[model samples]
Target chain A: MEEQEKPTKVVDARGSFCPGPLMELIKAYKSAKTNDVISLYSTDTGTKKDAAAWINKSGNQLIGVFDREGYYEIVMKKTK
Target chain B: MVTNILILGDGAAGTIMANKLRFLTHREDAEITVIGNSKYHYFKPDGIHIPLGIKNYRDSVKNPKFLFNYGINYVRDSVTRIDVDNRNVSTQSGKNYTYDYLVIATGDRLVPEEIENFDREAHHFYTLEGSLELKEKLSGFNGGKIVIGPSSIPYQCPPAPYEFAFQLDRYLRRRGIRDKTELHYIFPLNRVFTMENVSNYVQKLFDEKDIIYHTLFNLESIDAQKKTVSSLEGEDQKYDFLILVPPHKGQQVITESGLAGDQGYIAVDRHHLNYGDYDNVFVVGDATDLPISKAGATAHFQSEYLSGRIASEISGFVAEELYDGSVACTTVTGDEKAFTLYFSYTRPPRALFQSKADYLLKWTSADTYFSGMLRGVM
Candidate 1:
């Protein structure tokens, strides 16, 4: 397995549903500085797609999506 | 002079709105009047059980007269025209009424004719008549290729097709035809559901139960003569029993009045449920094009916020409370196990956990729907 990249901020939103994790990601993205690496942990099945959609739409860099034991983690970097 | 609050259609939204409005406003100040043709206020969700012989037709229905709160007016006539500019509506009975506020909760109109051969080959449980028809046929069915799916986007309930499939699996097993029957499900989307997690969870269940599913199989038309239904993707599936969720449009009056938006749905302010450019006009339920699942819970939630705002405005308070789209329901996976789905406009759903508690809740929801939710007390 490749070495994991540490993020500037980690947001855990495992208990929330589809939009909840996505909503939290947006909130974190808006306040972060340029080049700030952010990671989001979510249990929602749609967050992987929804967060990626938001990232692509907002012109950010997607690092990777890691499937953990019970939840998944999405890491992205602020590009603009 | 009494302020007239006219609510069109007596579906879950309209009836509850009228009742909630009645509670907040004094009868001397404003009179609530509902217009619809149906004498019975149907709990439509329970209609799905009809084909399985789990629910009686009468069990899914209630007299509108008994459901309405005292002092509210009931007009047992269909609305033929809505002249919103003049604030007047004309009914089929040649009667007209002027309103200070209008609520359009007419729900959806199933247009099965959208697909060729649908009228001849398909059986569904979305409507009372369709459910009864399917029940008679389904109960007599022994073994064959049973295909079930929605014919179009934005059908009645989001999780209904999946639930129907699981319930049918159990039903067939109980009837000793499990080994002989083949169950197939088709969805228009890329997955079995819109949400990724829920879709994955349901896909797992489908796999375990040996229920075959096809994603992105958009319905084209059915060739009843060939006993086959074609998809937009050039795929064809032969079937002995075809059950497709009826394609829908906005209610008749809504379409006639030019109030319905794309695909026969009303476009409204997502937060306030207000009709375009008309503050006094509101919409709720399956009628609105809010990009949310059309369920009774959605309409009921909208009613709570809508009635409060209308009442506040009428009382000169002018509250600024906005509604966050929230809808909740229980989807049964089998005979007595279900999972709860709850979400809002911005929040996604977390509904993968199945429990008997949720199943019991789903079972008793029909009773509470009429007594508590529709009664506007819960």
Candidate 2:
């Protein structure tokens, strides 16, 4: 990842359950400025699939989904 | 020879078992039939959210018929009797079903009438209708004492009353009536929760929230006209609004069918979910006297083990897995935060503190889990 692609804010939602991580990401996105990248780290299995789907459906730009050791991270940019 | 399996009830337990059975058995090897009183499956846990206006009643309902895609027969009928001696069960419509094996998953029955004046005065959030009514009542409330009490123990979802109290506290604060409304939680047990760690954690939260807690206050009766409730120890308390978790018993059909124990619950071998002497009959969910919290999570865990057992038996092999009575529950404290507990019969429940992530996990996974259970994926 390039320095400019780095998230403005990183939400650590590890040890939380599914929608918990996604909800945090949405909250961060709501408070974020346009073009500001936000990354959510979650251990919940459903976060990767559900959050990606939600971001795509809401017309946000999903940078990438990464599977790290023991957690998954979803990066998104607040386009609107 | 084709094995005939008849399952009672179409709630969480019955539906999951039906879908799993369909997946495990060959079409020509077994015939699976499920009989339930209602056409729609209501996620009972979500009823608590209804009164708080977090979700609507319609969102919690799903057609049970939609779950029967794998050639399993779904019958919408009330069970009247189960002649275990003859291995036949009768329905209210005079339909008789004889089976080589039977699964009893009929859930608990709410009996508010057992308490005097409760039927007339106390409001509850257990049923779909009651939740909707409570939602309307809560919206118009301005101030006064709000009492949430459980009429008896062994109720479904052990954490519900406490969760309701927490959510109610949050609700009143949101409505800008927090100072005017006094929140009280009355429990039958000596502590807030049966599990020690959970009780201690919740007690701290309760104290921080300034919610009054009354312990060992088993409900005796309610005076609707006076807006008061009396405890078994002759203690009386007044309330402007009452949210009662009414007394629950095994479905009448289980007792009427002469398959229930003295406490009106099916007596099953705790580990195997089988009744002694009735080799072919098994019980699960709220219907069994399993000495565990009668919640959907318990049923889900039971299904995980029981499904394999039934499948092995049907395949002419001895079933091996033993259920550990594991239970997992997520308690929504308020709109933004929630907590979860996971435990088993032999272990104390481990508590996960309140977080927005936990809340979202519960909110998002509920629907997917429901659909997955219906499709026999989980």
Candidate with top DockQ is 1
Score residue B124 of candidate 2 by CA lDDT: 89
Please identify model 2 stretches exceeding 4 Å from their true place.
A1-80
What is the CAPRI rating of model 1's predicted complex? incorrect
For model 2 chain B, the run of ten residues with the poorest summed lDDT: B187-196
Residue B104, model 1, lDDT: 89
Q: Docking quality tier of candidate 2?
A: incorrect
Task: List, residue by residue over B28-123, the lDDT tens digit for candidate 1.
Answer: 889899998886777777755778887777877888878899989988999899889999999999999999999988898889987788988999
Report per-candidate TM-score of chain A alone.
Answer: 0.94, 0.91
Each model's fnat? 0.00, 0.00
**lDDT by candidate, in order shown:** 0.84, 0.81
Superposed Cα deviation of residue B330, candidate 1 (Å): 1.0
